[model samples]
Target: MVVDELNEGRIGLEEMKVGGIFPNLKVFKNKVKEYAIERKFVFVPVDSKPTKYAVRCKDKSCPFRISGRISLDHVMVKRFVPEHTCSGTMRGNDHPLVTAAWAADTCLGLFPCPGDVRPTLIRAYIKDKWGITISYVKAFNAKIIIHEKMCGNAEASYRILPAYAEEMERCNPGTIMCVYRSRELWTGGDSTFCRLFWSFGPSIRAFSQTIRPLILINGTHLRGKYKGILLAATAVDGDGGLFPLAYAVVENEMYESWL
Candidate 1:
């Protein structure tokens, strides 16, 4: 699911009551971390377990602390001390709790297209929106994390090609799907993916009967971490609209690949 906003009516550190209930431990932890980031404070975990979680202000002298425990499949806050006695000097641009995974999830909505997400843009966005300063490496890592979350990793995607082709053929009986692998499979138990081609049954029939005779074949470079070319075939319908007929992904635009 796509998350559009943060803190969206969810309870924060200040708003949390002693008996407040959170859906799960992850939600409770995320809320606390987000609160810490927003308030420019630091929290150190005092007690962390499967059924219980506890944290106090980074400053040992501070009296602010909170703890929650799992109760009947939900985490219930058992202790709450929202006030802090120490001066907020431990907070700064860098936060130890802000991880790449957390940043990726927090700003997922900003990355509609993974290709356009640059590290510099991510850094600027986080700084401007959340008042948090993250290093370039963290921003770059966050981009990678978001890319994998949006589109599966390259290795996993390659491994599932055969299953995807089988499922496609099963769903559309007349669909044509093919996966080619390189001959080098001795070292790694999995075969190296070379190319993939697919065409839907409905699209083939529509192109043959209703679409225009003119076929436009074009090839574009894939923008993911893997370097490849995306070859596509489309036909102009009666309304001057392009209708997709087939697609192929190959290591390069070669005669054999097109064939």
Candidate 2:
């Protein structure tokens, strides 16, 4: 019932704010805890398993790497593992397994496109939130931003995207894959495709049997509706996938074209 009476109640928590003891705690929200404290450290505990929401370093050299990000489809909730070894400094940044993985990117890309390439939430967290230098290539575990329009019952667009994705894997086996959408995929002046593939190509192979062994295609239509298509094709790879793959459709009736 009173401030001095709190200790008599035998509560274990110490360092109650001044206002918290009183009726109105809003005035004490800004008060500091008198206990020992330090800044947010830059280390993940050894043996600590991180949540899907945790960030990975954008540096391929960083030791604290993360697994897949949380998504509407792959709604994973797993324990964390230390990105670095339990003890000792890391060997180097490029040591593959022991080293970290990054999302190598030369340009800023929006996401849910399926391409391993993308601008990450880590980039936003670093640049916008933390003001840190986030590397596009090194943030292997960062979540790429997705267009709300691009996500849907197709399970956030990742479900139906596998068709072209199969081709991307077939053609560019080692490369990270992606999917995007556009309302219009025109074909002319090297600018036939809609904005989805506006920046994409004149591939090595045209739409023929032997020439069109592999493909990747999707669209990120501005309307955010279910009305776009994309495609990419390539030679079969050792994995029975394709090679020299492009990523989307640049023409009309693309889904039908795939048929």
Candidate 3:
């Protein structure tokens, strides 16, 4: 049961700090794992207790075992057998670059435009910070994964469009919002996204008063899992500023979509 609990990867009560002053068992264990991973080593737990914990390198021939004791106010290192007879290079989730959560947090503040995030930039950033190199494929996948983490999935977002539109109309009266769905011929039943159009009340009022008679229209392809196009209309204000009138997401930039 103890081994199973340890393998479950959850921090137990024994691993938690009693007060602000005392050190946590999980904190000590994480620090040990962090140290080993940073130095490119793999370890397995040999023994675990409330007051003491011990871990040895996975390599059978290696005599490395890091053992420490939990004290009243601090964690104390009891013994350190720092010798590994392993021959293989470093691999696995222990590496910082390979973990999705870590990668997401690392790139969260850096990439404002998810589409512009490149593998080369991610690799360069990781190398500069941690002095570790990751493969281009890994970096690319990390970019996508991090973006998904930051923004909800495209399909899921589409599902909630109706609720969002309803909320907008409720919050601001005179808001014009429409969602169109079409059934696939081959599927015979399931409905797919056709088009979505929305114009906020404030924007409609503002455009009517301060915007020019001529409206500029444009469409851009959405580079997401669900391929689509975003169409927008804007008018110039009296002060030469761009005033947004309305926008729509459609299957394509067709005459029907514009209408």
Candidate order (lDDT):
1, 3, 2
Task: List pairs with backbone clashes in candidate 3.
Answer: none
Identify the runs in model 1 with alpha carbons over 4 angstroms from their true place: 1-9, 89-92, 109-125, 150-154, 170-174, 183-188, 200-218, 233-246
Better of 1 and 2 by lDDT: 1
Model 1 over residues 1-259: C-alpha lDDT tens digits? 1111244344544656788777777777887888777777889999998778999999999898999987656788899888878767345687777889888877777877877878888889888877889999998899999888888788898898899999999988789999999875677665788899999998999988999999899999887678999999999999999999999999889899999
Best-fitting candidate, measured by TM-score?
1
Q: How close is candidate 1 to the true structure, as a TM-score?
A: 0.74
lDDT per residue, candidate 2, 1-259, as tens digits?
Answer: 1233323223222433221232222111111110111111133323222323333333435554323233333223232233443333323222221111222221224343644334465455334422335455545433332323233333444444546555655665344444444434455432122322212232332333345444554443322233454444445655665555444443455455554
True-vs-predicted CA distance for residue 158, candidate 3, Å: 2.1
Count of residue pairs whose backbone atoms collide, per candidate: 0, 37, 0
